[model samples]
Target: MVKCFETGAYVLNGREIVKDDAEAQAKLASMLGQSADKEAAKQGTMAYGVIQAHNHAEQGGLLKLKFDSLTAHDITYVGIIQTARASGMEKFPMPFVMTNCHNSLCAVGGTINEDDHKFALSAAQKYGGIYVPTNLAVIHSYNREMMAKPGNMILGSDSHTRYGALGTMAIGEGGGELAKQLLGKTYDLAKPEVIAVYLTGKPQPGVGPQDVALQIIGNVYNNGYVKNKVMEFIGDGIQNLSVDYRNGIDVMTTETTCLSSIWETDDQVKEYFLIHGREGDYKTLKPEAVAYYDGLVYVDLSAIKPTIAMPFHPSNIYTIEEFKANAAEIINYIEVEGRKQFDVPNLDINLRSKLRNGAFMVDQGIIAGCSGGTFENLTDAADIMRGGSTGNGTFTMSVYPGSQPINIELVRNGAMETFMSAGVIVREAFCGPCFGAGDTPANQEFSIRHATRNFPNREGSKPTDGQISYVALMDARSIAATAINGGKLTAATEIDVNFTRPKYTFNKSIYDFRVFNGIGKETPETELLMGPNIKDWPAMPNLTEDILLKVITYITDPVTTTDELIPSGETSSYRSNPIRLAEFTLGRKDPQFVPNAKVLQKLEVAREHGENPVELDASLAAIYDKIKSIDPEKVVDPKEIGIGSAVFANMPGDGSAREQAASCQKVLGTWANFAKQYATKRYRSNLINWGMLPFEVSGDPVFDKDDYVYIPNIRSAVLSGQPEIPAYVIGDEVKAFTVKLGSLSKEEREVIAAGCLINYYKVK
Candidate 1:
C-alpha cells in the first residue's frame, strides 16, 4: 500500500521521517543540533544537488540547466535534428543518442521507417552523435546501459526516460527541448519541489516492481500528489530491491506525472554499473544529514498486492484480488467508460463477453518496453513459465527484451528458450507493443500487458474504425502467470512456482558491434539521407497584433492525453511530415477536427493575404459582426487579427512527451488551447515551443464547438506579461470570460512572440 502525506515532512539521515507540523521543527532542531531552516534543508536533498549541478543560472528559484547528455528514438530524433538544424546548430554540444526502436518495423510505411533510420545515421555522422541501429536497444535501455551515471542529468525526447534508480536524473521532454540543448540553449524552469518516496518493508515473493509502481501511481495520480515534482527514493526498503527492480519501478514514475526522479545509491547500484562495464560512472549519492521534502509518499512494499491498471489509463488501478472479486462489475464499468471515451457511433466495446466460467480471459499478454523488458523482470517471468504451457489457443504471448544485451543475457541463461518452450514468442528489442505499433488485438479482444501505459488505443485498436480492443496493465510476473493459465486472469502469487533469480552478465559487444557511436567524430561533409516522407517544418508565422480563435474541438473528459490528441500506432509513420501528421491529429478522438480546422484555416490564410475573412467565408460574417459589437467604438481590422483554431479540454496533455501533440495542432493552424489546467509541464512547454498559447480557464467558460473567441491586443498582452486576459466568445451574443497564461518566462514570451522556438532561434 502507498500513503501520501497531506503536508511536507523532513527526513533525517535518509531513514527517519518527521512530519512538518508545529512540533516537527523542534524535533528536527533537536536532531540536527541547530534551528531548523526549511530553505537550507531543502538544499540538502539529492534532487536539489543534481539539479543545481546542472544549473547554470544564479542560485535562485528559476533554473537554466544543461543536461549531461541527450537521447531520442526514431519517432523523435529526425524532427528534433530538423528543428535544431533550422535553428543554426552545427555539431551536437553534448552526447546525443538516436535509437531506432519505435520505428523498427520498416514495412509499416514502405520505406518511411528505414529512411528515418538512414537519416538518423547521417545526422549522427554529420553532427557528432550516437546512433543505435534498429533492434539494438530501445532509447531508455541504451541510456541506462551506457549513459546514466550517478549525479548526471539526461534529457530525452521520449516519455519514460527515467533512469533514477541508477542515481541519474533523466527527464523525458519534447523534441523542442532537445533542439534547444542541441543549440546550446539552457532548459529553463522554476526550481521544482522534491517529494520523498520513503520506502519500507520487503516485497513479497510473487509481487513485482509493477505492483509497487501501480500502487504508488494509483495513490498519487488522480490527487496530483506528486505532479511536477521530483520523487526522491529513500529509506531502508530500497536495499531490498535489485537495481533492475528499482529501474522497473522508476520508469513507471512518468505515470505519476513527476518531472524527474533520483534515488539514494548503494553498492548494488555500483555493481549494476560494473556489470554494464561502466564502473567508473558509479558514485555514492544520498541526502545530507537532514533534508526537507515538500511531500512524502510512504510505501510499504510487503503490503502491496499483485496490481492491475484497468483499461484507458495507467492510474485506473485495482488489486488482482479486488478485480477478481468484482470482475463483472469492473468490466461493465470499463465498458461504460470506454463508450464515453471513444464515443464513436456503432462501436461495440463488449468487455463482459471476455468472462468465461466466472473467470476473465485475455487474448494476449505482452512483456515489453523499458518497464517490462528489464533483465530481472524477464528472468523472473521465465522462471514462472519455465515448464508451463501457454496452450495453443486464441491466446498469444510475446516477450521483447529491452536491449540486445538483455536479450543475450536471456538467451545465455536459457530464459529465452524457457519462454519459447512455454509457447511465448520472443521478439526483438522494440517499443512497438508499448505504444500501439505492434501486437494489435482483434476487435473486442482483451490483452494484459506489462507496458508503460494502457491509454485508449494503446493496444492498437482504432475506435474511429469501430475496431475496439481492451488492455489492462499488470506486472510481468502476473502476465506470465496468466499466459501459463491460457490467458485466465490470475495473480502470480496464486501460483506456487519457485523463482530462480538469475544473475545477469552484460554483453557489451552487442552494442559495440552494431551501434554507430559518432560521439566525437563529426563528418561535416556527410549528406542527410532524406526520403520523400521526411520533410522540413513549414514556416510558422509570428504572432499578430490580435487573435481570433475558433473552437474546433471541445472535450469534456476529466483528462485528455497526448495519444488522443495525436494518435500513436501506424499513424506515427508520418511523424516526419508535419502536414501529413497533422491530418491525423484528433482523428481518433474527434474525426471532424481536421476538416473543421482546415475550413477556418482557409479564412486565416485568406486574411493573411490582405483579404477579409468575411469576404472568403460568408459564414464567419456574423462571428465578425458579434466581435465588432463587443467594442462598437473600436474598429476591428481583419488583417491585423490572426484567425486560427483552438481546442478546449477539461485537462489536456497528460501522457507522452511527443511534441507532435502540440506541433500537430500548430500545423493545423491552432493558435491556443483552453484547458482547465495542463496535465504536465512538458505538454504546456510543447505548446509554448510550437507557438500556441496554453490558456487556463477556471471552471466552464461556456464555449461550444465552432464558437469564435476574439482576443484583442493578444500579442502585446503576452509580450507585456499580462496576467488575466479578457476575451469574448462570439455566439448569439458576445459573452465575456477570462483566461490566464500562468507564469511565462521572458524567453518563453519571446518564443511565443516569434511564433515558435525555431523562429525565436532564427531571430537570434
Candidate 2:
C-alpha cells in the first residue's frame, strides 16, 4: 500500500517526481528556468531557506524564542506555572494562557480541580497572565482561534502543539522548556533535517482527514522515517483540503515523531483566520522553487482508505475493509497481546459475539479532542447519530466539541438537538478520556474512538492492578456507525449518512468577556501563592570523577514511552512535588523499582556525610572487595565515586511532553539511562535538565538486574568537556563500551558536571 523512494527526489511542477539525475535536471531547467541540482550544489539542501530564516531571526546565535502567546490545558498548565514560580518568575514575560479543559470534570481529586481554576484566575490578576475559565475551550482550539499567526513560532506544553495547517511553526515540549522561556533562556538545537510531505490527488467521497493522517503515521512511525525532523507540507493537494480538514490531519503529526510541521497556506487558511477575527495574521507561506529536502514523503491522498488502528498503539493500523475480511486472525492476535494485561483463563477473543448476522462489534464510541472535536467532525457525527438510538445492550456513544464556541455553533445549527434526540451525550471539551483521566470501561470491553492515542492504560485502565480495557482508533463516521449498530464495528462505507459541511461563524465575544489577556506588562509587587502540596525541587549532586550505578529497572522492549515511565492519570496531581512524585517512579511498570533505587540513594547520602558507604549498604562492600582485589591502587576516595541507579530500555522517551519521566528518576537517585536510542528531543532535554546521563549501548550484553556498571573518569571527562566517554560494564565479564554525550552546549556540559541543570544555574 506504500512505497518509499531510495534517493531523495523532488516533486517538480506539482505532478512529476524527479530523481537526482541529468534527464530530471534538464526537465527541471525547462520548467523552472534553472536546474535545482546545480543550485543545490551552490547552496546546501533546499530546506536550508527555512532554517536560515529562523537562524537570522536570532542573529545566528541560539534563538531565545519568546512565543507571541501561550495556551495550555488543565492537565499541564498548573505544573508549568508552579515550575516557573519555583524558578523565580515574578510575572509572565509574555502572554501566557491557562485553560481548564482536561480536569473540568473534577472526578478524581475533590476540589483540587476547581481550586486550580480559581488559582489560575487569581494568578492572571496578580501577575500578568491570561486565564480562560473552565469549559471555555480545548487548548489547541483556543490557540487556533486566537493565537496562531503565519510565519510565527508558538511553543506549547502539550504534545500536539501543531498549527501547521494554519501556517504556524508550533512545537510542543516539556514544562521545563516553557519555564526556560519564562526565565528568558534560549531554545538550543542543531539544525534539523527537513522532509517534504508532498501531497497530490484528492480523497474520494467517504474518506476523512483521519484516514489521511493514519496513512501517514503508519508509514513513518515504525522506521523512524521522520523522527526529530521537520515535516514541510507542500504541493497542489494543499488546495484540495478545507481548513478544518487540514487541521484534523495536522494535529496528528506529533505521532510521526517529527520535531515540528509547517504547511503552504492559501485562501482557505486566510478565510479561517479572517473568520476567527485575525485576518491580519494570515500570510502565504510556500517553499522556494527548487527547494532541496533531506527526504520526501509523497502522499497520494486519493489512495488513502478508511483505516483503524487496533489496540495498543496508533501506528498499528490496517484498512477497515481488510480487517473485516480477516476478522478471526486479527482477533487472535489481539487475544495473544491482551493476555499481557489480564489473567482471564480461556479468554474469548471472539468479538464475534457482537458480530450478530455478519457485522463486527464494539462496546462504545467517542468523538472528541483535537482530532475529532472540530466543528465539521462533530456536525457529521451528529448527523450520523440523528434519530438513531445507540441501543441498550453494550453500545453507548458520547460527543465532545473542541471548545465552547463549537458547542454554541452546534446548538445554533440544531446539531446538538439532533445528537440529544438520538440519546448521544454531549460533553464539554476535555482531553480526559484521551489520556486515561476519564471514561473508564468495564473489564474486557472494547471501545472505538476518534481521540489521539490508544496506548495501554490510555482508556483509563490500570493493567498492573488487574483492571483492563481496550481502545481502537477510528474516524467519527466509523464510530457513529458502530454506535448505530448497537456496538458492532461497522465501516462507515457500509452505512448511508449525509454529511453537511456547515459554515463556521466564530464568536469572539465569549473570549473577550471571559478570557484574561496580559501581554507586555510587568507586575513586580505580585506575590505567588504556594499550596502545601507544591514543593521545591530536591538538591542534586554534581558528576564525580568515577561513578557506579545499580540496574534498578530494566525492560528489553524496542521502545519505552513516557507514559510507561511516569504514567498519566492520577499521578498528574503530584507533578509539582518532585520527591513525592518520585515515590511512584516505575511503580506501575516495575513495583520494586522505587525501593531498590531508594536504597542506592541512601548509600550515596551516607557517603556525602563522610560515612563509609559499606556501613550504609553492606551489599556494596562485597562488590568493593572484588574491585579492590582487581586493582588496589585504583581505589579512590569514597566521595569521588557517586553511587546511583540506572535503567536499560531499548528506546526510551516516546509519547507525551512530560518532563516527570526523567525528573522522577533524578529525584530517585538515578544517574544514567542506558538505552539503545532516545525516542524524542523533548525527553532527551528532560534528561539533561535533571543531570542524568542518557547513555546508549549497542549489541546484546548479559547485563541483568543488580549488575554494576562502572564509569571511570566520568566527572573529569564532563569537566574537561569531552563529548565521548569510555565506560566498563562490570558483572560476569569485563566489557568495554563507548557512551556519547551527543552535542552539548557549554551550559549543558556544566549542568552535567554540576549534577543538575538547576544546580548549575544556582551555583553560577
Top lDDT hit: 1
Per-candidate Cα RMSD to the true structure, in Å, reads 1.1, 2.7
Alpha-carbon lDDT, every model: 0.92, 0.77
lDDT of 1 by residue, 680-759 (tens): 99999999999999999998877898888899888999999999989888888888999899989999999999999999
Q: Candidate 2 has what TM-score?
A: 0.94
Off by over 4 Å in 1: none
- In TM-score terms, candidate 1 sits at 0.99
lDDT of 2 by residue, 1-764 (tens): 34445556666533456665548678778877887764453233333444454443445444434565666766667667766665676777777877787767766546666666766776776668878888788888888888887787778888898998987888888877777677766667776777778888887666777878888999999988889988888878879998888999999999889998888888999999889888998887776545666677888888888899888788889899988888778877876775653334554444445444666778888888889899988887777777787887767788889888888999999999988787788888887778877676777688889989888778877777766778888888778777877776777777787887788899989889888775655455655555555567877888887888888888876677788898887766666567878887876577788999989999898877778887776777666655554457886555557899999888888888888898899998999998878999988888887788878676764577789877888877776667778776676566667777776777677778888766765675
Q: Which stretches of candidate 2 lie over 4 Å from their true place?
A: 12-16, 21-23, 37-51, 56-67, 337-357, 629-632
Measured on C-alpha atoms, candidate 1 has an lDDT of: 0.92
* Per-model TM against the reference: 0.99, 0.94
Error of 2 at 265 (Å): 0.5
